[model samples]
Target: MTNPLPIPPVTLGAINMEAEDPQALAAFWAEVTGGTPAVSGDHVYMPAAHDGGFAMFFQPMTGPRPDRAASHLDLTVPWGSRVATVDRLLDRGATHLWDVLEEYEHVQWTTLADPEGNAFCVAEHPPVAGH
Candidate 1:
């Protein structure tokens, strides 16, 4: 019998977000992540700053922001920089929700909302005991 054709890998290309001001939102993300932001047609995009990561795209959106519990971005930093990172993000127009380290007592992440009220988490995950 003939072998079936090999299946190709599926990868994520970009994460699309809706913002009141796509350009400004894109710029904010670019500044924070050190990614380059560019506009094309009706959307603003920031290519991923790391290899194997997907880009970020912002589209024009109006009206009240939706409930973000359904989906949110989780940003990982160094092993002990969660507090400092949360402070920096706060200084850059992010509103702190709560520090999970204190609230949950089992997590090393902080939750915050961007200037436009999009929820995201800044986390510090320790390296596993064995690779």
Candidate 2:
């Protein structure tokens, strides 16, 4: 019997920034993350390095949310370890958005936001065995 081919590595091409002003927002993130501008149908796309381990995109929002949780980003971290990485992120200016360190009894994730009030999280990746 022939063995099956291995799956390819996943690449994050882009993510939505949900910016109130996309041009300015892209410029800000570009300065922060060394990103560049990508072009798409009258919209300015912000390009992120594929190997940086996370991807980001920008879109102009007509208005802002009245409350939180209505807006957030879902980010994935490597399996079984988040401490060192999360600390590294904090050092880079990502602030704590919310903490579930106690209420949930299990801190599934520690939510965070960037300088522009966009929220994302740090969480453990579910185990993947026999890959």
Candidate 3:
């Protein structure tokens, strides 16, 4: 079964996250992604690593944070760098959540929550070209 409508020519522009302090959240993400954070009006933007990549936009939170986020970021780091990356983030105020190392499929990842309690994962994989 398939839809008859043609696929839209749309691309992901940015991922918007709500933060109690947008600047702080942006700074934390900058540290994680090595992307510079910039402010425009009431939003803080963290540009993606390459052209056409989706940026991260942080907006000020106006209400209570949800108990669970509907989505989270899953970042891939250079092979053998997962431990160091997780350590760096932990030192920068990230909270360790869990770790998954399955020798059966050779998969490894570490889950952590940012200072604002937003959960993201760090997975080890071969560095992507041009990333």
Whose lDDT is greatest here?
Answer: 3
Candidate 3, clashing residue pairs?
Answer: none
lDDT tens per residue, model 3, 40-83: 88789988857655689999998999998899988887789999
Which regions in candidate 2 have their CA more than 4 angstroms from the true location?
Answer: 1-14, 20-44, 51-55, 99-107, 126-131
Q: Which has the higher lDDT value, candidate number 1 or candidate number 3?
A: 3
Clashing pairs in 2: none
Candidate 1, residue 35: lDDT = 83
Question: Model 1: residues >4 Å from true position, as ranges?
Answer: 1-7, 62-64, 102-107
Candidate lDDT scores, in order, read 0.81, 0.63, 0.88
- Write down the TM-score of every candidate: 0.81, 0.53, 0.82
Model 3, poorest ten-residue lDDT window?
99-108
Runs with alpha carbons beyond 4 Å of true place in candidate 3: 1-10, 51-53, 103-106, 126-131
Candidate that beats the other on lDDT, 2 or 3, i.e. the better one: 3
Can you write out model 1's per-residue Cα lDDT over 1-131, one digit (the tens) per residue?
77699879888788888888898888778766778999997789899888865699999885676664588888888887888878877787889987777554335898888878888888887766674
Task: List the candidates ranked by lDDT, beginning with the highest.
Answer: 3, 1, 2
